[model samples]
Target: MFKMKSKSTLLLMLLGAVVGSLGVTSASAEKARIVNTGKHVDNLIHKVDIRNLSYFDTRFDYSSKPYKMSQNRYQTYKLKRSLKIANMNKHKEVILPKGSVVTGLNDGKGNITYISNPSLSLKNQKLVFKTLGNWHGSLPIIKNNGGAQQPYTRNTAFSYKSSAMLPFLSVKSNKPFYDAEGLSLPFVSISADSQLIYHTKGSKYKPTRYAKIKKFKLTHSAITYYLAKPVKGVATKKVRSGKTHLYRATFKMGHVFQMMFADNDTDGYSLTVNNGRQEFFISLYQLGWKYVGSIVGLTGADAVSPTDAKIATDYVQGLY
Candidate 1:
């Protein structure tokens, strides 16, 4: 009887051991599968011409000013695009976290706009989205120079609005970085009171461009903005065949967000934009990370007064 009881105990222990091993193996395999799948998707995207697979839905009002006090109206635009990342391996739909939805807004002028919330726009239509995940990332930084990666990036809902207009494109930040040093990143706003009116290179060339207006109805939101350089364009065609034409404008990837991309990496505060135009332009002062406050307004170096310039500088420098 004693021998039989001892055998039964040994069998049960062995069974428990087997189950534990299997659990570990299963978890490891699942992780590997997800990694491999992500890699496969990346590779396929590289091989394909992204233009063929991607489409953007855009809507905006055309006007000549940022704030239209005469009409009591504001100019705006909204576009949403789904980039099909081709993958050979099957991928489960990735549901981004509550803050993972990436969004952007830009005017055709010098003002870049970011809308943190999608549902706030009263003028523009909602973006046509299929997959999950917003345009989200942070500025990149190296380890040796590490301090608190200041202006940490966060997923905030916002609405975008601005007066700047130029060719622009959205990009992902390669590493953790901060914007005060002056690297170009996406600029955004919660609502735009400005409108892109004209594109002028010289007295010889000019085009009358305007944006349709939209209004956002949200109360709380966030905005991100990006600056675009190295624009591409083709000379405009002449119908009369006598006058020299302007050009058909286009833009390429200039720079991504200055904020470094990390998981809740921001220690202080930072800013970003969501949707942008192909050819957007802006001044230097407006090109840094900004934080939105509840009562005061947008916070950043610009928001900081002359008295607080030193404080803002120190705060930005500490981000590095």
Candidate 2:
């Protein structure tokens, strides 16, 4: 009997040992899973957000009206040798494309004169020529109306100019000119050697009058801005002190954001944040000095990783 009792106690001790071992194994597995999940979250948070910088201020105000992001106006044009001359006698009027440049005109005579000044008209398509000399017959007018001979064919050889005109006196003043009204104008070139001044005109007017003989000193003070190098990865963290918090908000994954700033009085810059699939835009007076925000497109309720949020928040704050 004493031996049997001792054996029973031994059996119970072995069973307890086995149960304890199983419990330890299960707990270890659960702990390991939690650790791995934490690591994954950290990785997602650190992932970089792609950034594209632009010199144009692409932010718009939509407080009173529904906001719509502007579509890209960039076009691809194929270069062609010659364009069809418009036959005015057929009562056929050809309007040039908005951005087309007229380098030369068919003087309504047989001769095509390669003149220095070119006119670019944005609104009208009719190519009308003020006769320089009576040919006694209708001349062959080169149709500069913005028709693509073939799809995407653009003749850039002609000096193309913007339709918006700047006052001749303002350009000659040699002082920095700002289109306070945000008007787009053609590039103006003043001759350093002669009093000849040339500007771009549209096909609506005569080509010869495009060039002007005016006296003005050459000034190299014209100001322009170019796009800065794009930044990759998330924004760094830096806190700024101001009355308004520029970029303090929760954003979901795939949300897009843009920050626009004026580097100087004459130049502007834009920073775009492409998060997941959604895009958002923000236009600021100075980096973070003053700003207005808008939605670039539709967004959803997907939560973004903490790291991405931090990176984006820190980047905008760093700019300030």
Candidate 3:
């Protein structure tokens, strides 16, 4: 997405995903669309209404180790030694005592944990600064200090629902495209939703003008994805390769639920759990949006346990 003009700009980050991340993949310049079109191929769809109470069942505890939980959404974790901390929102750094107990919620992107300090007078004062990368790999939040903003905050802490979501929906659209040589191309596409996803390399795209987008449907579950209205997406920039239909949408469950798309990127509809902040990008002439809508749809915008990740993965994998 060309430094989207709105929300300041939704800087695009290709997930380098599982099935569909904002990451890029290599492929022949040739472009083509599958003969079959419409209704997203039902054969690839494994139907199980996410609405079923069964889907929420943490059916499998993938971990043998004990994981802590909170009376609410916040879970418990311990620091073996004193750890340096900062408040992303306030830019004030603090140090937690050795053996400091932190309580909070996470969605992988913005894993915010805080020590209940009796000394701190302000309620918001307890906010702890922890980036996804610091805790693990290149996990991400929003732009500089956007802080952890929970969407369900207005009512009972984002409903204790968030995402470690996306993917699982699968990219099943038959994108008809032509390379500079005017050749039809085939790339890796993963079917996560209504029966399919089609891709040759499992990433990125260089788009033709939005000359004509055949009418197709965005299938996959976004069940109560915010427990309400789907986050409205923003049509970002119009790139040089003839307008990569770049767009973004966000809602909070407990964590940030941000979804990005580049009809030109073939990365399909990938996502990232941030601090309810949106800023990502896909290089020009690379990536594609196969339109996977919402996969596991969790975003764990407050991604806490691998448990949430597992549940989403299992359901998408048809285990649910």
Candidate 4:
């Protein structure tokens, strides 16, 4: 009886060992699969045109080869940080948790007017789309130096309003990076009560360059504003025929964007007008990466400040 029991015990132990081995192998395979997925995505990045992709969405920030870039906004644009909301009307303002999938309901120019979550909305049957972002412009510092294998390149967001619009691409940094000298970089914010009124609805430079305003809208302090009809036209060198019309959106405020395509050249704007009340022309020249020069507000040139001129003149940096 003792010998028979020992034989049975031996058989059972051998079976258990085999089963454990199989389980271990299965776990190893799953880990290998995950690793391969990261590699597969990283490999595809090398073969595509980077410009067509939104900077934060597709582009990787790598300074060397054997690029390690998979955890970017490659899949979807998610909130890196939580945005708080205190809705006075609905009494249902909740902090949007990190990693909320941002749905598309924008001004077609990356200006997210609102984000809708029906589950979060109550009382009002309509899905209350609290604004996902207010364009707070930014200034970023690149880790640039000689002898570095890969110096950081220009990768700013397409929109002028950024949490950082440096180089006008979508890259975010919570804290300013320090140079080799350990000096903290400075930040620039042209935040002002500014406005811009221009139209890009006309896709052609036809017999008469005209666009009935419809594409863009400005939201300031929870109040949205649209461009009124053009009351009069003005002459400017920015346009070829000098037929810049002042579409009626009076902005004593600062810079605001007029929408454009990814590869379209900037359109011109007439001076800021107030139905013959006030006329000011502001012009800004983007000399280079971090240099914006001049703000001329006059009768025929429409701009409130230097930042307004910079944004109104060159809002489409083409990073989208």
Model 3, span 192-296: residue lDDT tens:
111111122222222111111111222232221211111122112232233433222232112112122233323222221121343212111111111112322
Could you say which candidate leads in lDDT?
Answer: 3
- After superposing candidate 2, which stretches have Cα over 4 Å from the reference? 1-126, 129-197, 200-206, 209-320
Off by over 4 Å in 1: 1-207, 222-256, 259-271, 276-310, 313-320
lDDT (tens digit, per residue) of candidate 4 on 1-320: 01112322442353221000001111111111000113332223222222222222222113435433222111112444444443313244445544433321222233322332221212211222333221111111111211112111322221222211111111111221111011121211110112111211111101122223222333221111222233232112121213543333322222222112232212121111111233222111111111111222233232245543353224323321
- 192 Cα displacement, candidate 2 (Å): 24
Model 1: lowest-lDDT 10 consecutive positions: 17-26
lDDT of 2 by residue, 152-251 (tens): 3331211112111111110111111111111111122211111112222112122222222211111121111111111121111222325422211111
Question: Would you list the rank order by TM-score, best first?
Answer: 3, 2, 1, 4
Error of 1 at 317 (Å): 17
Candidate 2 local Cα displacement, residue 247, angstroms: 51
Question: For residue 230, what is the lDDT in candidate 2?
Answer: 12
Query: How many residue pairs clash in all the candidates, one count each?
Result: 88, 21, 73, 21
| Model 4 alpha-carbon drift over 4 Å, by segment | 1-65, 68-126, 129-320
